[model samples]
Target: MLKHFNAKSLFGMSFLVIFVLLSSGCDIIPGRHMRDQAKFEPLEASSLFGNERASQNLPENTVPRGEWYDIESNEALYTGMQDGEAVENIPIAVDRDVILRGQERFNIYCSPCHGRVGDGQGMIVQRGMKQPNSFHSEQVRSQPDGYYFNVMTNGFGVMYSYASRVNPEDRWAIVAYIRALQFSQNAPLDVLTEEDLEQIESVVE
Candidate 1:
């Protein structure tokens, strides 16, 4: 049997065996054999995409689950825009409860840079961070409610977008709260309640 097998015949048989094994998907190299397997973690970058983002945008015209109302029907509510401009009013109704919710969300998110009263004197600013414009400033106070909502959703200047962290409804709530803050610092005498007047008089006294 040894004499019957020449060197070329043995080499040919070995090559044939390797070819069959490869065709049948044998993992000769163990862990390194699966070169085409794709594994992507959240927020990881990938060269497979032109944007190098592992997370791809949803298909056009397809709304994700539980987002149809905002994405499909109420674009203004979600994006804070109408007719190519920021809407002059918040699309959602403003109420005490909504304002309170806004206050809570704003304290957690915006207060770091905008301050508790939106004076742009937050602790970060005192610690040498760039100070944003005060909400009480005439320029800011004159901006429409949707303008603030747009800034919160899309960001402006050095501020980053909160669209991912703050939901649309809560963003509107924060906008309402910002208005309340502005009014508190610049309220007219006629709009003050008796109790408010008394408090001011006591403070002045």
Candidate 2:
């Protein structure tokens, strides 16, 4: 029994030694001191930068990190602005896949207010919210693509911005889908091909 007790005591002592070493090992760890070096906290006053501020101004031409994309360059892709004006186009490729993605995103985020057909008669409006302008209206149909992006990003009268909820690319996708909805309701019969006319006739019949 004494031998067993001694064994346990030795094991406890070894564990205590290990615990002390690990708990205080930060002082011996290289670079940890530098990482946690006592420096001025942000906005604290100091004479280091000649302005009596610890925060030195960033160097000139300091490009932001991950700025290779057009989004970071004040391009039409992210800000929907070009030459100080709202651009009239989508900066990305417009294709079936993009349109489909737009449709999915629009159905999720916009259909609640704009309706599936873009008629501003969604369930939310039916439930007593103010109805928004229909996208098929001539005013909206004539608007530049960037207008939609801006609205989605910054919101409009009686509408909250979707910027927090929708990413920039998805916001453009939703704009494309909105254009599709506008075309769907405003397609001129005079421009319909013979095959398309026949298809419509069959549906009518």
Candidate 3:
């Protein structure tokens, strides 16, 4: 009887140990480690969904979190467009300081492709890159100020977008500087003041 009781007790202890070991690794129960949980990774294909793609498109009109938004609801301010057309002028006021800021940004960003004078003769072009159109060209000058902003934000032919590197405000500033560069190369003689002419004559002398 004593031997039979001992055997029975040993069997009970072995069963309890096995039960705990099995339950510890099982994730179905609450509070178990889920190190190998099922999930989809980027670009991973899946037949579970009808589209057979792991990624889904974001809903329209919903901006992602941590993104900048225009609080005043001025769509043109951010998009450089109004009523399906590029705006004709800068949305913000332009002053001497604004132009100066634009010059700094232009030299850093635009001068690499478009030369320091907007003449499409930067060092990159000298090294066998395609030459960009001069800002002083009649065709280019005819484009509205916002057109330049749009080009920078969305990129033109052979040019990558600067929208990530440059904010909308700075894009507008660069546009203003481009206009200044164009005027510097093509200013009308009638617009020259007497003092300006004197300086020109002095340089000529």
Per TM-score, the best of the predicted structures is: 1
Write down the TM-score of every candidate.
0.68, 0.66, 0.67
Q: Give the TM-score of candidate 1.
A: 0.68
Error of 1 at 164 (Å): 0.3
Off by over 4 Å in 3: 1-67
Per-residue CA lDDT of model 3 for 169-197, tens digit only, reads 89999988898999998999999999999
- lDDT (CA) for every model shown? 0.90, 0.87, 0.88
- Span of 10 residues, lowest total lDDT, candidate 1: 63-72
Clash tally for model 1: 0
C-alpha lDDT of candidate 3 relative to the true structure: 0.88
List, residue by residue over 64-86, the lDDT tens digit for candidate 2. Answer: 77424555575788878777688
Model 2 lDDT, residue 64, Cα: 73
Kindly give the number of clashing pairs for every candidate: 0, 0, 0
TM-score of 2: 0.66
User: Highest lDDT among the candidates is held by which one?
Assistant: 1
Regions of model 2 farther than 4 Å from truth: 1-72
| Model 1 / residue 99 / CA error / Å | 1.0
